[model samples]
Target: MKKKKFLLIVLSLLVLFAGFTLTKSFLVSSKQPAPVPTSVVINEEKAIQNFSKALTYKTISFQEREKFDLKEFDKFIAFLKDSYPNVHEKLDLEMVNDYGLVFKWIGSQSNKKPIGLTSHYDVVPVLSGTESNWENDPFSGAIKDGFIWGRGTLDDKIGVIGILEAAEYLLTEGFTPSRDIYFMFGFDEEIGGDLGAKAIAEKLKQRGIQFDFVLDEGGAIVENMVPGVEQPVGVVGISEKGSATATLSIIGSGGHSSQPKDRTNIGRIASAISKLEETQFDGKLRGPGNDLFEFVAPEMNFGMKYVFANKLLFKPIIEQILLKEPATAALIRTTIAPTIFQAGEQYNALPEEASAIINLRLMPGDSLEDVKEFIVNTIDDGEITVTVTGTEASSISSTEGPQFEAIQQAARNVYNDSIIAPYLMFAGSDAKHYDSISDNTYRFLPVQISSDDLNRMHGTNEHISIKNYINAIKFYIEIMKVTNQQ
Candidate 1:
């Protein structure tokens, strides 16, 4: 009897385990088929060679506007014309702001709004002491260990080359777009893009040229980007946080060291900063965070899927867990960080005035007025004055419609197994300049890179794998074909 009871218990456990496995498999297989590309073939070596050669030019953006070397910019353009002869001959090219280049490929029909693709050519300056950190000369155009090394490999230049390669290849194959396609390249994106993308946007707006969508550089494929997910992740920026600078200042009477009041200028400023830190912007999972889970939920394991699939019940708990990490916490709320501070001269004397500069990244619904009010209420010190200067957050673009689906389809076509999802970009990009004329604007970089490679983007030893560069080119071609089909 004892032996029979043990056997029955073991059999029951086995049945339950099998049922769980079957149910999990069913959920995973329920996902819809991803859009597959008609064809994908690109010469990886040739693309790498072209990218390496493009990196030879030093088109750096300096804080002082006069320090810009137009000669190098001219060289970069000349190189493009020489390398992509078919593109130069087939498409109409125009120069704005002397350095910004716009290429228009006319389509069979003119009724539909045009699609715009943009990237910047200029790069940030290489600091003097960081040169030694590079494995090879930063501008040597060196191909080492299956990667093309340089300064602009992962920044905006890859977007420029990848787009041109697709256009040139399509032109060779006698493919013409059904709707107008505009390839806009900016030169001074690193220095705020005032002279490049912003100028181009204003010019296009004046001519009543509106775009169905605008795609620019912002996010890329990252490994372990999310906490629990093991697959490679791709983030598409549907909205970007607003950047603003706030100055807090306090003034008091200067006096000798021995005779001090309870509240000095420095003390007041310090106390205000402490209060602001204690009372940070509200961090709750909303907006882009919610959108991101919708796309990835179907691909997750049962435990993760259950939480995401039934988010209404688990949202508060999930958000509370996310709030524990600072980086993830920023996704749901505005952030405040004191960037610069100024105060007294000598230890013996009290300072008359003290000031601090705070950098704030505003969320979608938050306004400049809301930020000011929050600061005032939190500190509650009338003697301390505050002032703010910057643009409000850009409007959020739609994740629905053929526009977003097209982007997702194109990404899946190139990156076969990866999950493509939408998230809010924490940093600023040139896409903001097009918000006025574009109903949907997305920022995505089509390349598989590790977190280390991501760090190298604006840092030394910046490079891209030969395979990734070819994939990027193929992605652009696939996007063009998909857009035309729609």
Candidate 2:
């Protein structure tokens, strides 16, 4: 009789737990209905012409600074001045560090903190051998098949020209911002942004100028971005991963190829890399990656919604699923990419020293020292010299408040069918540099694009559809207006 009573008690507890979980899932939705979009009119013909013309300049950023052509950059600057006369005439412009452009539109309300829009003009150089793969010349900015084909069309020139065009339009409409607006363009974002964004940020910091928010080019609107949601999703990057380069090197005795030792320096380096790969950084759904799901759960199908809403009960299962894909896996943990391997120069000789460089995109809380220590412990090789050097992850920005709401509403106004969610950026951007000066820096490139288009960035045959280009301008305009009202 006592045994039967204990079994009944256990079953009742299980039933209650299940009931509570289902109820919680149903009530967990945090989605607020988006506001009605304010109609924005832009001159599509003139905007396209300006965007196409801006891409003609060869403002390419090369790893080696000496390879840049100052003439092309200078011409691009001149073109902007010729194109947007209203912006040049009304806003105060300063050329920081020569190529870095800063324009300030003094606000009607001085008590309100300034807001910033930033993007880089420099683009990555196309590979010499891949030029034939392009249907149009990468630098030609060909308007073919309703697509603008060029190198910088997607990587970032869109942000630079889009923001300027919107500003020019607003000025023409006799609209002034309630808060001061600053437009900043960097010249060397492709390399490290040290000369461009870093310099501009330093200058702003010295002036004791703090921004309410600064928006830069990053995550974009995409279809099938998340697995469960059917509508297109626009991801606003609330934080970006820190980039670190770790070098693993070993020195050992050199010998002839025919009689090489069992453990050569090259062998040690390769083995170390293999071990690091097998033992990756811990994948946990915390921080921005976690925040992404909370915002999207309400829109997901019932099954996905249930699993995500009760993460405490199903966290391990969800993480395992996220770990299955390279794309999704990056969201929850730091990533390891072995980019450069250097060892032997000759065909028949075993070099005494071998070195491999592993590039890691660190999670927000993962410090440089923590990453280095993790690498050292994973390899378990006392002989291998491990050295890590790079900047730590940028501070995570708040998803709440007017700063985020303005961006979310602006995106919704332009792409009403899409859901806007905060996501962690796996790659680095110039926005990280601005974090020091701004209270919150958000990375969102206001364009609807696909995975194929993303792959084309810094690759052959890069292009943006005409429709995407126009909407990008509209988003900029909306963002400006919405931010002021907030």
Candidate 3:
């Protein structure tokens, strides 16, 4: 009788556990029904022509600061004034730090805090030999085959021109915003936005200006990007990973190659790197990474939805699946990549010193000093010294409330079928700098693009479809209108 009662109790517990999970799966959902899209009409031809023309200026941001062509940037600024007369004439324009452009559109209500729309105009330079790979001239800004071919067409001139075009159209329609809107354009974003965006952000902070939210170029509507979700999903970055560099160096005795010691400088460096790779940063599905799965779980097929809904029971299984792909793995944990390895100069002679640089994208809450200690402990070698230097990850922005809802609603109004979700950005953006002055900072590039298009960014043959460009402008207009209502 005792044995039978014990078996019955075990059976009851198993049934209770199963029932609990099934009930939770049925209750949890992140999916929202598609809303009716608001009608927006614009002169498609003129907008396309303007965007195409704006891409012609080679305002490239080179790593070496001396290579920037100030003349081209000046011409680009002039082009903006000439193309959008009303934006320059009506909005208060200030040239922050000479190249940084700040345009403030005063609204009817002064009580409401302002919102900012920002993007960088400068683009990565076309690699010297890769020029031949482009279908159209990299600098041509050619409008053919229903696409505009150029570097900045996608990387960001889209944000600058798209916002201006929408603002110009709104001015023509005599539409005044309920709250103030500021459009900021940075010149040098590719090489760490220190001069352009940082200066602009500091300037605003000095004037005691605090914003409700600031939107900048980042995640976009990607098709076939999210696993198990058939429809295209637009990802807005609520937080971005911090980019830090860790240098591991060693100073040891150099002997003749013929009578080399068991361990050389190069060997030690290689061993340290190998150990770090084998033992990577512990992966945990939390923060923005966890938020991404939560948002998409409802849209996933029954099997995936069930697994994610019962995350408490299946968290390990889900993490194992995510860890399978490098792209997906980056979403969960801080990533380490050894970019530069330098050692001996001569092939035969033993080198006295060796150094390797590991590029790390830190997850939120991971400090640079902590990461350095981790490296030092992980390597476990006293001979080798480790040093880490870079900015910590940006603060996580709120996904709730009207500010975020305005962004989501605007995206839905433009792309009715796409699911807009908040995510963690693996790459960095200028939006991080605005965190000080803005209550919330969102990183989203309002365009529907594929993984291939993402790869082409900062690569050869970068371009944007005409339809996508116009939709970007429409998104900007919708966002402005939606935020005004809030």
Of the candidates shown, which would achieve the greatest TM-score relative to the real structure? 3
Those runs of model 1 whose alpha carbons end farther than 4 Å from true positions after fitting are 1-38
Candidates 2 and 3, the one with greater lDDT: 2
Which pairs clash in model 1? none
Clashing residue pairs found in predicted model 3: none
Best by lDDT: 2
lDDT of 2 at 148: 98
Order by TM-score, highest first: 3, 2, 1
How far residue 27's Cα lies from its native spot in candidate 3, in Å, is 1.0
lDDT of 3 by residue, 394-432 (tens): 999988778888888889898888988889998889999
Write the number of the candidate with greater lDDT, choosing between 1 and 3.
3
Model 2 lDDT per residue over 1-486, tens place: 999999999999999998998898899865644766758888898999999999999999999999999999999999999999999999999999899999999999978999999999999999989989999999998998899989889989999999999999999999999999999999999998999999999999999999999999999999998988999888999999999999999988887899998889988899999998998999999999998998999999988888998998999999999999999999999999999999998889999899999999999999999999999999999999999999888999998888898998888888988889899998789999999899999999999999999999989899999999999999999999998796
What value of lDDT does candidate 2 attain over all alpha carbons?
Answer: 0.92
Candidate 2 C-alpha RMSD relative to the actual structure = 1.4
lDDT of 1 by residue, 1-486 (tens): 999999999999999866765565455532323758547666666777888999999999898989998898999999999999998998999999899999999999868999999999898877799999899888878998888888888997999999999998899889989999999999998988998999999999999999999999988888788755667778899999999998999888989979999989889998999999998998877888778877777777667876776667678888888788877888888999899999989999999999999999988998999999999889899999999887777778888788887878888898877778889898888999999888889999999998899888889888888888888898899889889998
- Lowest lDDT sum, 10 consecutive residues, model 2, at 29-38
